[model samples]
Target: MYRDHSVGVVMPAYNEEGFVGDVICDLPEFVDRVYVIDDCSTDGTWDEIREAASRDAAADDEPVAETALLADGGDSALSERATIGDPVGRVIPIRHRENRGAGGAIKTGYLAAVGDDMDVTVTVDADGQMDLEQMPRLIDPIVDGEAEYAKGNRLLYREFRQDMPRFRFLGNSILTFLTKIASGYWKTMDPQNGYTAISGYALANVGVESMYEYYGYCNDLLVKLNAKGMRVADVAIPAIYGDEASSISYPTYIRRVSWMLFKNFCWRLKVKYLVLDFHPLALFYVFGTATAALGVLGGLWSLYVKYANGDPLFVRASLSLLLFLIGSLFLMFAMLFDMQVNEQKEVQIRE
Candidate 1:
């Protein structure tokens, strides 16, 4: 245990047979449980998980901790034990009957972690891209009561930025800005990064079951956390790019996640601003957006008419420009207010 808190690592595996085994073995001994969920990969991923669990169990100096591999129908009582009669295993391998996407698999592990009453839950993908050594940085803030959730930010350092693929770096940058607006965490970056740690309290309160079950799950979770007034810290960490290929299609992912963020933003405005606290920023956002759209459209049409018929119509053009300026000012002030309201949430836990 680290700092007298039981740590549980949630590993979500797809077709990562080779890398998954190594990841399981490389976990810090301080970790009390590893919930490795296989998302119904057609490969030998399941075998790798069991083999690695058995290997870890055999090599343990202390008695292996009791664990159950939930495989039968995904929820039935431990029907197929990895090792019969020997319930003491650190790695608890759970398999899904069909693919539930990465978020779904993590949700399964999350629920299991909540059920077991783990002190902290850390999510690390089974592709072996995340550095096991940097885990302490992610956990320190949560353990010390500084933040409720700590996420790894690879883009925080210049040297680390060179390691990421150029396309991914640019795409992640765009998503970062969009997510900051949607999640209401203006100071936070790298919304796509998966390496993160959360306290048990956060897990139970973040509405895990209703979390987005797609590539944008991390972004969606941030919005929920912000709405619930949970503290989030971004820890500087390096990215390890390797042989494992990403399954995501960037264009489709960006589009879908963008739409989802918009919906979440609207929901947050109503729930947090109107329904709960009743902040004026919500009005600023709604009216400002409507005013901005009207201004842009009016300005364009006025310009077209002026050019088409040589009609000066100075009054119309000036009025359109004025409306746009006012709208822009409203939006700017609303964002400032939001940032101030959530300034405490984006903690600076640089460890």
Candidate 2:
């Protein structure tokens, strides 16, 4: 066990037959349990998982321990037996009857982690893009209490440029910027990077089952964490892009991320401002929105009156321009103040 913690790795898979074995095999020796959640893959992925589980058991320093594979229809009893039996030789795999997307599968693993009383839960995709060797670095911060959640930030470090595509790089940059504003984790980068670890307390408190099921999962989780007042930290790591095609389509991501931003912004305003009594930024946002709307309406009315010869063109135009400028300036200043307020909050927490 690394640093007196019961560490578990959650690998969510769907049709990952080609590299699932390699992903499982590459996990470090210190990990206590590797939970593989096969999200109803039609290919031989489940068969490969079984093969890998057996191989992993035999390759351990000790054999002859009872192995539990897939928990026989989500049985927690089997999970406990496989996890508690031997630290070295047992493998347990949990299978889902219906396809529940990757996020849902990881939620199952999170439930297992909590039920098993695991100290830490690490999620790495079964697609084999993540570097298993960096697992310890990701686990260290949470184990040390530096942060409740630690995530990989591929853009801040140099190794990320090796295999990353240009379009993906740009898109990730845009999403990360929006996530910082929405999630209040302004210090974080590469917000879409999925390799992450969280303490059992944070995971249990955040309620993983409620997280979004598709591409918006990570960003939504970040927003949920911030709403709970949990700390989030980022660790720089290398990027891996290969022959495997990403199942996340561009248009789907754009639509989902946009909607998630709107939802989280509204939720954060209600929770952090109205419910929790944090600050007055929410009031400022409201004022800015109202002022901007009024300015737009007045400007349009003035233009219509002037064009219809109902008023002096120069006087109406001047008044309209003045109102628009004031409203726009108020909104801009409000946004700037919000950024500063968030930055100060982070600094205070660090101190």
Candidate 3:
């Protein structure tokens, strides 16, 4: 156990066949359990997990649970859940009946951690990009009662993100800005970073079943945490880039996630402000967005009418400008209020 807390690492693997074994072996001894989820990789990633689990001379006789989860609607080659354990720690390997993406794999690991009564759970990808030595740092805030959820932030500075690919860095920046508004965690960045630790309380309460099952799950989880008033911390950490190719299709992934965030934004406002308690920020956001949209539409209409006919444009253009400014002011105020309301909910854990 790390600092008297039962810490578990959730490593989600896809087609990471060759490198998966090393990532599993690199986990610190303090971790009480490691959940390696194989999302039905087309490669031999499952075999690598089994090989790594046997490194400690694991005992496969003692099964945690003998039951199998119902497979997804189609024919899946995967089997029931199985775990390997000796004396030091347990290595639980779960294979999805079908490919459920990275987020779905992590959610399976999260539920496994929750099921085993783990105190703290941390997520690490199986590609060996994350530095396992910093695992303690990620678990510190959650163990100390400072934050329920703590994540590594790789985009805090230029040097921190230097090793990241230029395209990935650029896309991450755009998503970070949009996620700030959507998740209402203005102080945090790098919503897509997967290196994170979450407490059992937050895990059980965050409603993991409803979380997104794709690349944008991190962003979706942030929205859920904000609505539930869970404290979050952003810890500065470095990322290692290697020869592994990204599995995500950036163009399609970003488009779908962006739409998901828009829907989540609306849901969060209602849950946080209307359902639980009454807050004017919800109204401010609604009116501000509506007026800003109307202003842009009105401005375009006025320009079209002026060009099509000889109608005067001054009054109409001026009205559009006025509406846009008012909407902008309202949006600014709403964001400020949001930041204030969540001020204590965020902690910047700089190294």
Candidate 4:
């Protein structure tokens, strides 16, 4: 265990038969448990996970510590090592009766990890895109008490920027911006990146069952974390793309997640600024939104009046522009106030 903390890895697999075995076998030896949740794959993914578990149990008596696969440039004999040596950790395979989305699978993993009393839980995708070697970096912040949640940021490096697909990179940027406003984590990016680690304390406190169970789960989780005043860190990680097909449709995904973020933003304002502890930023937001709505409606009414009757529209235009300008300024001030209040909430990692 790193830093005397019990570490666990949760892999959510959905028809990832080609890569699930390799992902499981490559986990670091320090991990105490591995939870593989098969989300009702139509393929042979469950069979592969069962076989991996059988191999692990069969080799319980072997002294494979030194020969086991190391995260630091290990040999490519994964299948052989997996079948003939003790696994890095106990593999607990869980299967869903029907296909729950990625978020649902992760929730199942988190519940199991919490139940096992693990100190830290890291999420690794079953598609083999995330680097298992980077597990330590992801969990270190949580272990060190620097952050309650740490997530990989693929956009930090130039090579990653070039490696990610253009469409995905653009979409990630937009979502990241919205998440910053919604979650109050101004310094964090790559909101859609699923490679992350969370302290068990934070996970348990966040109410796993109430979290979003769809593709926007990551973003929604961030908002909840912020509402609870949990610290978050963004660890730089390289982007690794493989032959795995993406299930997301960019247009639909962006629209749906955008709406989710808007709702989450409102919810955060209500819970954190209004319900939990009163803050003036909430007033700024309410006044700004109301004023902005009135300004837009007034402008539209003025335009209609101008077309319907040959009346002078200068006064109406000036009033509408004044309202719009004032409303925009108030909203800008509210955002600045929010940033100032949350600046200290960010997780500061000491090297």
Candidate 5:
């Protein structure tokens, strides 16, 4: 119940029996409801949750005193009356029938929060990679009407140099660049960062029908929100790296990320140009691609003709060079304009 709003924390777990209880115990006490979602774990995760819930229910029913003092200055100790109180545990554990991946677990948590009518839903990984102490700071902007979604940027961490993985560091950098182009949030860094908090209104607005279910979930959500005109803001949060093992394979990683990138790019073209009618950027992109393709084809044809004739190179060389140069310049300018437009959009939102 921070800032007049009920905060719900969702921790998605799968085969996380050892760490699940730790996560539940570590969550802040002020969180009105903490939902532990077991995405069909094969281990004793369900049993652990049941045990925790039972213990919590018992604690909630513990006896507490309620006393009223008289105006006659009665002793403070004797004026109180003991009454049975609600358990200290407000955490609820939910289990899924089958495996739905991390994204699916998140969607489940989100739907639950929405049903509960919570003011905000904060998604925290069950592996405990994110700092729980920074939860309030991440939720503050959304609560204050400054942004619809708030994301944590690990690179902004003051001590990012300490122990961040090299591969993850490089992968995040490349993906961030590509996602900015696809999602139109050029100002955002670490688009793959999943430590995010969203306002209830925004969550409801972002319908879950077409949400991603794999590793691409975070990036896909960013694009969807951008297309829906929801503003996303980044908050500085430190990275916590430990024994968490990543199960992502290179082939699967490439396929998922490529599909998401293409989907977002096409969606952006359709919405920003056709549906919204924002600017001429779409036309420029189309024209640039066509011109560049034509120029490449023309150059190849000219070279073939010259090879067959074994004659004058003047006509072929001049036309090919001219078209290639003009097409390349046009394509470059189009990309530059797209970047500028995206930057301007971010600036306007901030202002």
Candidate 6:
């Protein structure tokens, strides 16, 4: 165990036949278990997971080398010792009958980890894009009680940012801004990065079963964690891009996730400010949103009226400008209040 806490990695595979085995074999030795969930891949992903599990179970004394041959290939020459020890941990293969999203697979793994009494559970992608060696760094905050959840932040360094595509980087920045406002974790970035670790307490308390079961799950989880006052740490980790195919449509994914965040923002305000304890930030947000909407709409209507007829636009313009300025001030104050309230919840893990 790492830092005296039982570590488990959850891998969600979807048509990742080529990389699943490598990911499984590359897990750190300190990890106690690896849960591989196959999301009804149309390829041989499940077969590869089974083969990896067998190799892991068979290699009792030494690490086993990974082979590309099928499990039933019956090639004796392909069996070789791996570079690590005994494949580190036992591989538990879980297959879903229908194609649930990556989030669903992760929830399944979380449940299994909780049931097995694991202290820390880390979620790693099936496609070899995540560095398994960084597992310890990801779990450190949770193990140390500094944070209930920790997530990889690929934008922490310039070199790491250069590794991402230009378009993706821009998209990530926009989403990060939205997520900051929605999740109330202004210090965190890379909202889409899925490499994360969570304590058992968080996994059980965050209501995993009711979480969003799709690509937006990461952002959604942040909002829920914030509502529960769960501390979150942003672990600096590099992005690793490979030949793995992406299943997301950028435009569609962004739109859906944006809507989800808007809804989550409202829910958080209601649950945290209205139901749990009354806070002035809630009023600030309400007034700010309403004022901004009226200002924009009123401005547009005034412009239309001026063009349609020779009506005086001075009063309308002044009113819109006044409303806009007041709304912006309220929003700024609300943001300050939010940051102050959540300052203690931002976990800082020193390297």
Number of the top-ranking candidate, with lDDT as the measure:
1
Each candidate's root-mean-square deviation in Å?
3.3, 4.8, 4.3, 7.5, 10.6, 7.7
User: Residues 1-351, candidate 2, lDDT per residue (tens digit)?
Assistant: 679887888888889988887788777877778778788888988888878877787777743322233335334543432222222344457677677776777777777677666789899898889988888888887887777888887776665654567887777778888887788778888778889898989988996757777767788888888888787778877756676667788767977887888789789878977898767777777777777777778778888987787687676666767777777777677667656655533311110
Q: Residues 1-351, candidate 1, lDDT per residue (tens digit)? A: 789998999898999978999999999988898888888898999889999999887877766544433332333222231112223367777877668788888777887777667889999999999999999999999999999999988777887777777987888888899899898999888888899999999998989878898889899999999888899999888778789999999888899988999999998888789887999999999888988888899899999999899998688888898889889999999999999899988886553
40-156, model 5: which lDDT tens digit per residue?
A: 889888677667656654555433221111233322221121111122366656666667788877776776666566788898987768889988887888888878888888776
Compared with the true structure, all predictions reach lDDT values of: 0.84, 0.74, 0.83, 0.81, 0.71, 0.82
What's the true lDDT of residue 46 in model 2?
81
The local distance difference test score of model 5 is 0.71
Q: How accurate is candidate 6 locally (lDDT)?
A: 0.82
Residue pairs in steric clash, candidate 5?
60-86, 60-87, 60-88
Arranged by TM-score, best first:
1, 3, 6, 4, 2, 5
User: How close to the true structure is residue 7 of candidate 4, measured as C-alpha lDDT?
Assistant: 80
- What TM-score should be assigned to candidate 3? 0.91
TM-score versus the correct structure, for each prediction: 0.91, 0.84, 0.91, 0.89, 0.80, 0.90
Q: Per-residue lDDT for 119 in model 6?
A: 81
lDDT of 2 at 343: 59
- Cα deviation at 210, candidate 6, in Å, is 0.7
Candidate that scores best on TM-score: 1
| Candidate 2 minimal-lDDT segment of 10 residues | 78-87
Winner of 2 and 6 under TM-score: 6
Q: Which stretches of candidate 5 lie over 4 Å from their true place?
A: 54-89, 158-162, 293-351
Kindly report the root-mean-square deviation of model 2 from the true structure over all alpha carbons: 4.8
Q: Per-residue lDDT for 284-321 in model 3, tens only?
A: 99999889888888899999999999799999999998
Candidate 2 Cα errors over 4 Å, as ranges: 62-90, 158-163, 296-351
- Arranged by lDDT, best first: 1, 3, 6, 4, 2, 5
